[model samples]
Target: MDVLAVSIFVFFFLLVTILGFAAARWRRADNLDNLDEWGLGGRGFGTFIAWFLIGGDLYTAYTFIAVPATLYAGSVVGFFAVPYTIVVYPIIFLFLPRLWSVSHRHGYVTPADFVQGRYDSKPLALAVAVTGILATMPYIALQLVGIEVVLQVMGIGVDEGSWLVGHLPLFVAFGVLAAYTYSSGLRAPALIAFVKDILIYTVIIVAVIYLPAQLGGWDAIFSAAQGSFDAFNTENADAIAAGEVGAKGSIPPAAAHWAYASLAFGSALALFMYPHSVTGVLSTRSRSVIRRNAALLPAYSFLLGLLALLGFVAIAAGVTVAGDPPNPQLAVPQLFENEFPSWFAGVAFAAIAIGALVPAAIMSIAAANLWTRNIYKAFINQDATPKQEASQAKIVSLVVKFGALVFVLALSKSFAINLQLLGGLWVLQTLPAIVLGLYTRWFHRWALFGGWAVGMGWGTWLAYGVSSPTQAHFGGPLVPFPGTETNVYIGVVALLANLVVTVVLTVVLRAMGVDEGTDQTQESDYRADAGDEGVEEELDLTAPAHG
Candidate 1:
């Protein structure tokens, strides 16, 4: 192990751990025994904190490791993340404020809560809640995978010993994350995000500026990456032609144009559908804060573009991994280790590790809140008090983190990765139920539920049918568009099917005189801001959920 690097890593890690536990005291809520205070940091975060927290939540440790790794491995489509982030902000600007308004007006803590209020359908709300939790588990696992890669790069727990011995550090890190998140709730991540974003920006700025200068220049970096791709294509020409492996490239070919565009658009739609993203948006102070942060968040997309280029820099610098087939996820971390001074490399490692913690905390908390409000409070104990709800959420948050840890440790990393890819597709199924409900209650609740079921089943089937060289199922996000040779994102295609079913079923159901559930929200509710007529300073914990 590099002693200096490990020391710096440990120091920063400890700093965040201290910040995490201290966050509960930082906010100093009168009582956190309610969803509003515990699940959402009192629902009072301003522009600056919301910016960092949501940015940190969306641009995750997995992103830091995986996006560059895809580029380093010569997959040009991975750069879709830049455009995906760009596309998502305008959508957020348009719709998330409405969600925030309606959620605040109804004391809704999760998107499912909004669904329940809008449609007055418990079964539909439960579907949304369950989808959120299932999709989030593998996402949290990917964060652990991010930390594990950094640990491996640092030689922290790699040894000629049992699996348990090799992953003790990971377990210890998991323990720390679970402890403070259970204590501080959303405040933990909201506070630590300041440190996480600063460190990430510092490292990426330095890497983009310093690495290119060291490796001759951008010209040499591109040339090196292209030459490497050419060599690999030549070496594996048969495999490429036989459909066993994909050709490498710096730019998407004409054949991949639809694939690239669809991935970007699909990902943009899916990003905020995740419960954690909703958690970030709802925690903000007002409608304007959501819009302001949406506009400002694009700056992170610029940063992501620069960060993605580091993959080419890694190629030029000749960073390599040790594996039968080299694990590309290690490329960026390996580049930091090989190119930077030991102490600075540790800073970069800590950035990735802390990047994991912030999102993991938020995801677990979001999932827990779904359980408390939508599942536990809605079903098991309809008359449960706010304190009981909070207690359940706290315990479930720990359970969620522990489940994620087991997902990473017991299962193959590839399994978690593939499931995360499907997670995006699965969460997109809820878009009609949640996002559409904000605008109009035209679609019947049962129709929305049917659409979700169709989308979930079809998307999973499509993803499962995809096969890559190393994996037989759940291998990728893109599939051949039906009745055409062109490939498109599975989520986009599944969503189309979902919409078709929902639109058709709605007309039939309305004509048949099917009972549309009572709409609980008024037209003005969507436009309400903080301190509006029915919006309370704090959520009314004792108020019954609207049906």
Candidate 2:
């Protein structure tokens, strides 16, 4: 290991941990025994804090490493992340403000909480909560994959025989994270996001400019990447023809257009559906904060596009996979290692590691909120106090983080990307219930539940059957588009089936006079904003911590 690099990384990592612990005092909630204080940071973030927090939460460590890695290994197909993020802000712009408003009005801590209030169906709310927790697990695992790539590139914990020994650094990092998060709650991630974003923006900007020059230039990088992809495609031409695998390059062939479009669109729809994404929005002080960030958040998408190109830069730098099975996830970190001095490489590594921590914290908190409010409070104890709820969430948050770590340690790292895609597929099934339900209550609650079931079942089945040249199953995101020769994202196909099922079921159940659950929400509730009476308390950031 480069001692200088490790030292620099450890310094930043510890610094962030310090900030995480200090965050509990940063906002200084009068009471820490409630969901708003712990889970949503008192729901008092202004535009500036909300911008960094939401941006940091959504553009996670997974994107920093995995996007470039996929581009490096698979080519044009990986660029789908760019378009997906680009389109997401606009779609959420239309609906997230509504969600924020309604959630605020009801003091809802999770999307499932909103579902319960809106549909008045405990069972439907349970489905949303369960799906949120399940989808977040793999996403959290991908964050571990990001940190692991960074550690491997830094030459730390390189070749320990035992799995536990090999992942000691990861466990240490996660332990620090869990401690801070338990103490500071959502404030931890919100505070550390400032540092994480600054480092990431600095590292990405420097690497994109400096790395290309250090090798040749963008032209040379593209040429090298194209040549590598050409050779790869030639070697795997049969697989490509049979739709078993995709070719690697900056641009895809004509046959991949549908897959590209569908993946991008489906991912856009899924982005805001994830409970963590909604948690970020809900944590803001006002509906306007969500709206303004919707416009400003695209800045990260532009940065992500630049980050994705590092895969080509890796090709130009002659960076090769170091693992026995050849993990492409190492491409960006390895590229940094090859080009940068040890100290700066440590800064880059820290940026990626901290990036993972922010999202992981937010996801764990979101999942915990779902459990505490929808599952535990709803079923286990209706009389549970605010302190009990917060305590349960705190416990569940640690469990969620370590659960993700266990998943990564037990499974092949190759499954990280596929599992994240699986998370997207599963989370997207909630769109009709949450996103569409924002506008119309036409679909019965039972129908919404049926829709979720159909979407989840079909999506999982299709995802399981998808085979690549390397893996027999759970290979990639693309599956055969129903009723067409072209392939599309399985998420989209499942969503279509969900909508169809929901519509048909709604008509059948309505005509039969089946009981549609009561709606506990008012029409004006969806338009409520900050300062509205009965909304969660705002943070007293200027007040003394003990006041």
Candidate 3:
């Protein structure tokens, strides 16, 4: 029976994949071969499409599985995901258009390309590319994590001995995604986001409304959640409040408090800095497309709010997944199967499954762009043509998906999730270099590299010291260097230290007469426009892009 339900879900997912491949043709662009069309869906997504594409890409399938699971674990800190998302818009409003302007003016595809052309530092560009790709793999892995949980709860391979062999369902699932993403490039994922978001928004809205009716109301829901927390007092009490502990790990009070703040603040700041998110922003047609989408996309933030509340709904419905080997990631899926009708539950499953495809596709394209522009062209084959670059990226996209699959199947689910979190720490290290450098080149190229090294090393060591598997791989919050009692988000703590080192070293290096590389970019470059701008546009959309 569950096999039948999963079959229905996959059926719709494949239909969307086919549509995805056809998007380059749909958005008939004159320059399909360039980075604009292939890397960014042609950079002409108006507010309507940009709204769905960016929102779908940002609030992903992992958010579906992970947030409610966090609530189930009795941690108030997990709720921080809600506020952090809301805060991301205003912060992006400040920086993104400026970046779009500069990127558009200079014909920069990856942020690393901008760093290279701006500061004329190959090492700096290499650093950004490496950091972006490594940080992105775990993130891409988490998307598989989300879909795998959905398939598991649906009983796709119920009689299997372990999670690994049981994953035959996701094998077909991700294979379809890889093919479509490879064939269509950015256009595939951008087009499929419309279907994915519709499903996600539908499932979340219906569940938030219907689950309370089943649970007697919001009061019953919170009461059950609170009761569960009280029962876990001896073990999880302190850790829950601070959002400091991972899953159900042991930690001190002060550590958790700092950890919660660090995760929330740093994550908020770093959210838009992600290459995939940047790819979405840079793909828009006009400056207004980016700004309008920024304002309109808060609708998804509201959806995130509703999604967060489902954790309480799961508790109120008295819907405990019965198996002793139950995956905690199944909390939401199990809740839906128990609460919703089979048909609606099937739709909800489609929502989550399609939800996985949106970000996964976008992330893959973004990574491919980075690899093509930064490494493949920079070192391996400097004279590779546009077609050759695109071909190389297509091959790498397959390898990247399989790499994530290996992580998901070979490692514990908990470990995979932790690697994703560590990836967040890794990506955040780019802030001082990529995001900050956009506004000013005051930080010397050498200082930027120095700060990045220190930050990445410190962040990596912090992730290593924290146990990866026990908390399902989202290692506990970072500890202060000298005082392990005070914890923080590795991204925030390391980024701050990175900046401090950069500023101090910039001053010293300047005092000692170090040469700061010349920036080819101008101030007005950050304020460039689309139509009347002094830049050559890449993709002239004669029609919508499709594979």
- TM per candidate comes to 0.98, 0.97, 0.92
Candidate 3 at 427: error in angstroms?
Answer: 0.9
Q: Predictions ranked by TM-score, top down?
A: 1, 2, 3
Off by over 4 Å in 3: 158-165, 234-257, 322-326, 467-474, 481-485, 536-547
Best candidate, TM-score-wise?
1
Q: Which segments of candidate 1 are over 4 A away from where they belong?
A: 539-547
Tens digits of per-residue lDDT, candidate 2, 471-504, equal 9889888888877889899999999999999999
Candidate 1, 167-248: lDDT as tens digits: 8999999999999998999999999999999999999999998998998989989999999999999999999999999999
CA lDDT, candidate 2, residue 515: 94
lDDT, model 1: 0.92
**If candidate 3 were superposed on the true structure by all CA atoms, what would the RMSD be?**
3.4
Error of 1 at 192 (Å): 0.5
Cα lDDT for residue 508, candidate 3: 93
Could you tell me how far off, in angstroms, the CA of residue 366 lies in candidate 2 after the best superposition?
0.5
Which digits, one per residue and each the tens of the lDDT, describe model 3 over residues 187-206?
A: 88888988888788777888
Candidate 2 — which residues are off by over 4 angstroms?
235-245, 540-547
Candidate 2, residue 324: how far the Cα is off, in Å: 3.0
Report the candidate with higher lDDT, 1 versus 3: 1
Pick out the ten consecutive residues of candidate 3 with the lowest summed lDDT.
244-253
